[model samples]
Target: MVRPWIGLVVLSLGVVAAEPPKPVRVPLKAPHESTIPEGPVGEAIRLGQKVFTNTPLHAPKYSGNALSCSSCHLDAGKAPHAAPMVGLWASFPTYLPRAGRVGTMEDRINGCFLRSMNGKPLPTGSEEMRCLLAYVWWLSKDVPVGAEVVGRGNPPLQAPAPADPERGKAVYARACAACHGEDGLGSADVPPLWGPRSFNLGAGMARTSKAAAFVKANMSGLGGSDPLSAQDAYDVSAYFTHQPRPDFPDKVKDWPKGGKPADSRY
Candidate 1:
């Protein structure tokens, strides 16, 4: 007969640790400019690209901040991990917890205007809205409805080490201040990270988790490389996200049914 200690060791040897789920990501497949079909529809796509790249020049009234859509969406929403417009047509008409209900594609675009741009929404029937929809639709063509696209958003960062805002001040000085400026007011080439022109508290990027993930992937800004350590990302993100910025009066209405993120300023 086996001894009790031997049986216990055998049982332990047979146990296996659970494996983590594999992350899903598909390669970005948005059409290139040469792929735009020839005709009025193609012209519309071109116009939409211009509008996306030059919001201040095209939709000034609807844009309050200096930040262009390209600033975050990079490459006119074609770049992966920059919230590419590809597959968006298939992803929308979905539920948003912040909206507390399902919403249309147009509704989602308007939400970006109010928070990310810190500006008024475009009219539903406006030429700008139509052109934008046309371009997004063209980009998303042939994508199956409800299919998740890889690189659609910033990759989720592992839960960061506890952040320290005090340490963040130094990190910002060393890494971020040159481009964003010590005051965070921004320059002609960079968008303000905080202050009146920056995204409001209701904006998703205002959260430390969201900001840190973005920092890890894209905060290289002009350099276009991620140089910050995970801890540095967490600390600096916390510091800047907590800085003064525009406030959204309607934030009180967010997550009306509950499930607010712990890091949400509102």
Candidate 2:
């Protein structure tokens, strides 16, 4: 029997001819510090950058762990493929599968505090929140309202095998121990990969796939010399993510409408 898809493929000459064009992704970039306007708004932007780079130092009351906003975002949220905030202002209020609702930028930020920071939410009208919004707005000002930016998040890799923690332990010992420590309790400069002081179970980084993606792309830091294979990245990610860390009691509230990711621990 002649299948329906085979007939469509023959009529179109190829699958490429039947598909819609993909959107062009713009390069990720943030304005220079010198370009910040001279006024109260500028002051807010600077403070926001500080908070992002040093969340525990700037927002101690709301920071449950030692990690900062930049711990994951990297380069004050300007670096590509590390979850850059360059085009974020124009991207909300967007729908989130976890929350099962359309959320504003403020909602997203507070979500980070509640989960990633394992801390309390910043009041929408608080100084810290205002400063954060200002900083992100400035960073995203040059981007068009709905333009797609390349390297916005950690791009996933196709692992040759399913993630394996035993293999990951070896990868961590060889590649990560020097900086993150054998105990996984990172130093004052580096963020801990796992432990009570690290991000809680609810944080996105808690997922093996998310952590693997980030590790594969930027394991050491910005401009790292060595890169790991997809399997190594997955293995190391699985090893660390399965280690003990703070738990999110409210995790039951996530994915209220269903669509919970397969990698979710709880």
Candidate 3:
């Protein structure tokens, strides 16, 4: 009986030892590949390319100049100052120290038009605006959407209305052509308003109305002489909006990150 009891105890202990420990759950890793396909996104990118170079639609304010969105953006939509036209749509509605508020891609583009293109703003919620937005979305494929992308420098003073393109042409002849050139292809020091070096409509000047407002408040330097009236700014913006964009190279380049350069005053 003692031997039997001992054997039973050993069996019970063996059964206990054989029992498996509770299963532990491990988290799955994120997929390395993108879910979005290249076909439709590619089409949108092509459309964006056209929009970027299409200046006649916005009707930039300056005249006697052939400046277009492509002038600065370089190649279909590549440039140093502006980020790559791809995989960036996912980030926006981000905080900007320059503007002192969170902004969308539209706000960034509007800011560019006023300061860089010297153009007027496009109205909010317009078809043109949406189309431009669509293009940006296409470029940013597979990236997280609506994340903040900080800019460089205090945002250019809010853009004002565009000057009349016809009048702007005259202004270009008198005031701008010497430095920007008749083609609006600025040199290294000046930076071209339209061409490979210019910002794309989608990436730079999509929001026409906002861009206009900014120009009205400040132009020709923040506190300098020769500030343009709202109407004058609008007209000039209209003229530049209509110009052609330059073609981008096959490979896109990276833009500088964060707001403002260390050496910048504003």
Candidate 4:
């Protein structure tokens, strides 16, 4: 049996363990909008912003789903935990273990096109691609090369359950149905969870773990506040990700050299 003082010391240790040390962010500055000079370059930058926000409207031919780039990136990729695109201009040409090779920044965007947007890859060197790249470049104009942004992607959290679809269905009814609809089809104010218009199986959201991480960060207010517990997030994510949605033809090509995670639908 432990003494009361020993128990208190253990509790104090647990509390200290809970708080993760903050990561040191690279010192870099993002260009201001007012800095955009009036000229063809400015016009292109503005167009790029539109492309990020109104993807389907601008690049209808390439879009296969209803989501715009802003859907996941959030606020045209400016929001922190939603994976801001601000410092990515200099971070690319890096190796992605998923691809098993060093790929250009355009490759990353095209990966989203194929998976998240459930769309065809934009033609190389197309006007649409140029505009999208320009917008990202402008966002990183003031950022120095080889620097990192503090909040570039969905923040991590405690490990969630392996996911039980049935439990998730009930959780969704209580917590998510209000915003995402009983059928999992989101309304005009929100993005759909699963449907013909939703992201394909190749999207990161399709993975149970990835969806759980995203839910941990933003389950309310369009990725603003999370009201559900970690287990609930995993359950709901598993249920929705397993539901019928578009399928990616190139799923067979992914993780070609092995090392696929357990939750991969393919």
Candidate 5:
């Protein structure tokens, strides 16, 4: 009992369907170290890399904790999804909701010092600041202006249920304690996860969701391992973020114009 409509449907099936569009991600590219220009500019770039990889050693005056910039940025800020700095130059002079104003690259860098490092802001014209800017600019040469890179920051995650610190403690002991230590103080090579040396309450990582996203993506250590489930990530993040750490007095000034995330510790 074939109908005329059935013939039309059969004909339609012969044509192939178009493929769905893929997720967009800007390829991260940076100039090779061998190509760094010879002279003061090159010197600045080199110094900047040193500062970034070992902030406490290279820029001791501004370091208030044991953590280096590479502790968070990872692979000298070249690694994606771990807050990579590649393509970052183009996105700045952007709005910062926390500060309630447009912030330049310098402001952004200083903000990390104030919150993440629990240290003081670098003077805008200081040598350390200039060198860091030059390094970032060199890294951003390949990216187009006014473009947004997909992996610029940590990916967002939502837990299925409320985060449980007790469950997180178990997860941390099994997975994280090897490198970070049971005390959370970490050794000389590893950055502390909590206590006075960790990021202050004002840093973005203090938020449960932000930390979970980071842990889910990158917390398996340099060799890499199986990724954590969203619930486990959320739970572990909740446990560590609530641990005692430095305080940021200026936190009160944040979100002045309004629009603070619900996860903010303050």
Candidate 6:
């Protein structure tokens, strides 16, 4: 009987020993850190500088043209009628009447290649594109995002006729040169009207067709006093289009191989 009692006690002890303990719950907290690395911002800016002036990215056919992003964007910051790329990233995914849709920064960059650069469109989600976006974001940090950018910091559009280049040159020299400089290398508030910083002949300055139509409806900045005539627009555009373009590499060896050539519209 004692032995049976001993066996029962042993069995009870075994059962107690075999039972699992209750699990304790602990709350988890996220670490205090940034998702992106600290140095990447600077790196992105550097990479953007590289991509801006690289013509090789256009490749094959457009290789003859020495144009780069800087060719139009200029110093990667201040440009007028061309849009200030500095604060651009914050406002993207914004609406564009031309496209009849909202577009992101990437969309705008690709559009530049197509419309302004006269090159093929870059692939979406590409590293080069992302770097460019990052640079723009970094530049635009202080500027408010999503604000409507009308007339590109200029006054309302004028219905007057365009000015002649011969006449406009005098106008540019007398009225505009104080701020824009003789060569249209504009000061801080004013932007360059020509040089690598100016708009492309095919896109912003294209006088023949669609681009001209856009300019006629939306051209701005006549000092809020005398509006430019249609002829004024044509002649000034001629002068700007004739301005020199910057030299950049003809081919991008680093671009991924087997990439398709951009569509003809670019």
Best-performing candidate as measured by lDDT: 2
lDDT of 5 at 167: 99
Give per-model TM-scores. 0.86, 0.90, 0.39, 0.85, 0.88, 0.48
| Candidate with better lDDT, 3 vs 5 | 5
- Point out where model 1 deviates above 4 Å: 1-25, 220-226
Candidate 4 has a TM-score of 0.85
Q: Please report the TM-score between candidate 5 and the true structure.
A: 0.88
Off by over 4 Å in 5: 1-25, 221-226
Better of 1 and 5 by TM-score: 5
**Model 3 — which ten-residue stretch has the worst lDDT?**
247-256
| lDDT of residue 182 for candidate 1 | 100
Which segments of candidate 4 are over 4 A away from where they belong?
1-24, 27-30, 220-226
lDDT of 6 by residue, 1-266 (tens): 57998999898888844566444322211112233336877677667656775644523333223456665454454444444465566566787544546777776777667546556666666667777777666655545554433324223333255434576566555445666678766654454555665434335434322323333444435455345555555555545444564322322321233432221112
Name the candidate that leads on TM-score. Answer: 2
lDDT of 5 by residue, 28-135 (tens): 665688977899999999999999999999888998888777888988988888898888898888999999999999999999988889888999999999999999
Candidate 2 lDDT over 10-78, as tens digits, reads 988854545765666788878889989999999999999999999999999899999999999989999
Q: How many residue pairs collide in each prediction?
A: 1, 2, 74, 1, 0, 13
lDDT, residue 125, model 3? 70
Give residue 253's lDDT in candidate 3 (0 to 100): 28
Q: Per-residue error at 84 for model 1, in Å?
A: 1.5
Per-residue CA lDDT of candidate 4, range 160-234, in tens? 446788998997887788888898778776788899989999999899888987876767433333478888888
Sorted on TM-score, highest at the top, how do the candidates line up?
2, 5, 1, 4, 6, 3
Candidate 4 residue-wise lDDT at 229: 82
